[model samples]
Target: MLDSNKDIVLDELNKVFDTIDNSQVDQMVEMICGAKKVFFVGVGRVLLMLQAWEKRLNHLGIDAYYVGEINEPAITFDDILIVGSGSGESIFPLSIIKLAKKYGAQTIHIGSNSESSMKPYEDLFVRIPCQTKLYLKDEIHSDQIMSSLFEQSLLLLGDMVAMKIVQKKDIKDLHLLWKKHANLE
Candidate 1:
């Protein structure tokens, strides 16, 4: 039983890697490099990943902000939205995507399925193929085994992007990233 579980975990990890789109990653990097501002959002576990990206982007000297945070302005045409939602059908993200697009903001969405609603609306979609919603035999809270798995991948992916930016742009000082770290009392 343990072996089977291990195999399943390994297979899921491999599936996440296989679906990675290097070209889209490059495009996202380019967009971040060129955009006047960058905004990101995610409903749950993915939201944590988005927040991490926002911090890294800020460290890289990009104007980065997280949605729903105080004082963050609406995304405009010169901005980009990076969102993570397993279903891509979440009403909050879909509505925000549409509103942002109306203002000409570009969207980059990472989700479980390629055919999700957000897929049609986004300028770019990074599909993380997995069963996003999971449930235990008697649990009420969504298990999100796949979503959690994808979150790990997204974290790695974001770090990779940050490193690439540092290399391409000659941002070698680790201090820059540290400086962006929030200092709350």
Candidate 2:
């Protein structure tokens, strides 16, 4: 039964990958690789995905931080902020994006809505048309619990982009990435 459930979930995720536009992925990679610094934010479980992205970006030698962390630097004109909000209306990420933009940081938004309110603040919007809990009524067809597909696909998306960044920088030595890991651990 668990295997059956897993298959159903994977099938749903296939739809999400199919729906993502390649152009948006390219835009996201270009923005990250070009930024002076990169910051990330999201709310709830989605936030976990973004936080993981922060670590991976750092591993790849990019200056990246999870916003609101104690040591995170302030946004600047040369920085970029990448946020994932399934609803595109999550108030927290939206508010942070506004501040980051006010300081001249380029903002990239990842959500399931192209017409989302957060769109106006974003320099790049990567819409992955998956159903989220915020729109459960509109997504009665989804079998999994709220927004699982989006979160799963988000992790995959982030890792794929990070891999590209590694290749672009010609980072062939895995030990180099490992050298950047926090020693406190």
Candidate 3:
């Protein structure tokens, strides 16, 4: 039963990724690479996934910080803000994305609904195309409860972006990333 459940989840993930737009992903990679710094915003499990992505970006020697972190720096025109909200209507993230835009920062929203309120504030929108709470039309149906599929896909997308960054920069030695890893840990 455990293995069967694993297969079901994996199949769902595969279907979700298969529907994602590669061009949007390419733009995300370009934006991340060009930014002076990257800031992330989200809530609940989405925020947790963003935190993991932030750490991975740091490990790749990129300046990445989450919005509410104590030491987070001021976001500027040169930086980019990445918001993860499957519904794209989350009040906090919507508010923050607007504020980031007000600061002249580039904003990218990764969510399931492209027509969401976040549309006006974000410079770019990357759709995950999975089942959201709103159950919008054409969302890929999921066996997993709630937004689990979306959250899991968000994490994998981050890693995919990280790997693309490595490829683009032509970092010959993967071991060199260790230099940026947390030393105290």
Candidate 4:
């Protein structure tokens, strides 16, 4: 029964990814690669996924940091901020994106609702097109509870971007990335 449930979840995830626009994803990759520094912001499980993405970007030798991390540098015109909020109406993320824009940094929002409050603040909107609290007309329905599908898709989207960076930069040795991994553990 657990196996069947797993399959169902995977199938749902597949549909979510399938519905995502590749052009938007490509634009996100370009922004990440072009930025002098990349910053991330989110809340709850969404923030957790952003944290993992920050780590992966670091592993790939990109300068990435989360909003609240210690010693985080000031965002500038050359930097970019990626905000993850499924509803696109999360209070904290919305505020952070506003601050990021105020700092002259480029802002990108990866969320389900394109018309959300984050819209005005963001320079780019990469819609995940998955189930969200708004119950938008275009969202892909999910069997998973709450915003689980959006969070899961957000994590995978980061990975997809990381892989694209690898290909675009022509990093021939995967071992080189291991050098960036935490060794203290």
Top-lDDT structure, candidate number:
3
RMSD of 4: 0.8
Alpha-carbon runs more than 4 Å astray in model 3: none
- Model 4 over residues 6-97: C-alpha lDDT tens digits? 99789999898888889998999999999999999999999999999999999998899999999799999999999999899989999999
- In order, the Cα lDDT scores of the candidates are 0.77, 0.86, 0.94, 0.93
> What is the per-residue lDDT of model 3 for residues 54-163, given as tens digits with 9 covering 90 to 100?
99989888899999999999999999999999889999999999999999999999999989999999889999999999998889899898999999999999999999
lDDT of 3 at 2: 98
TM-score, each model? 0.82, 0.93, 0.98, 0.98
- TM-score for candidate 4: 0.98
Clashing pairs in 2: none
Off by over 4 Å in 4: none
- Please, what are the lDDT tens digits per residue for candidate 2 over residues 39-119? 999988898988889989988888998888999988899999998987888889989989988999999999887677788
Best-first order by lDDT: 3, 4, 2, 1
lDDT of 1 by residue, 26-102 (tens): 88888888889998888777788889888888878889888899979878899998887777777888888877888
Task: Write down the RMSD of all candidates, one decimal each.
Answer: 5.0, 1.9, 0.7, 0.8
Off by over 4 Å in 2: 134-141
Candidate 2 local distance difference test against the native: 0.86
Clashing pairs in 4: none
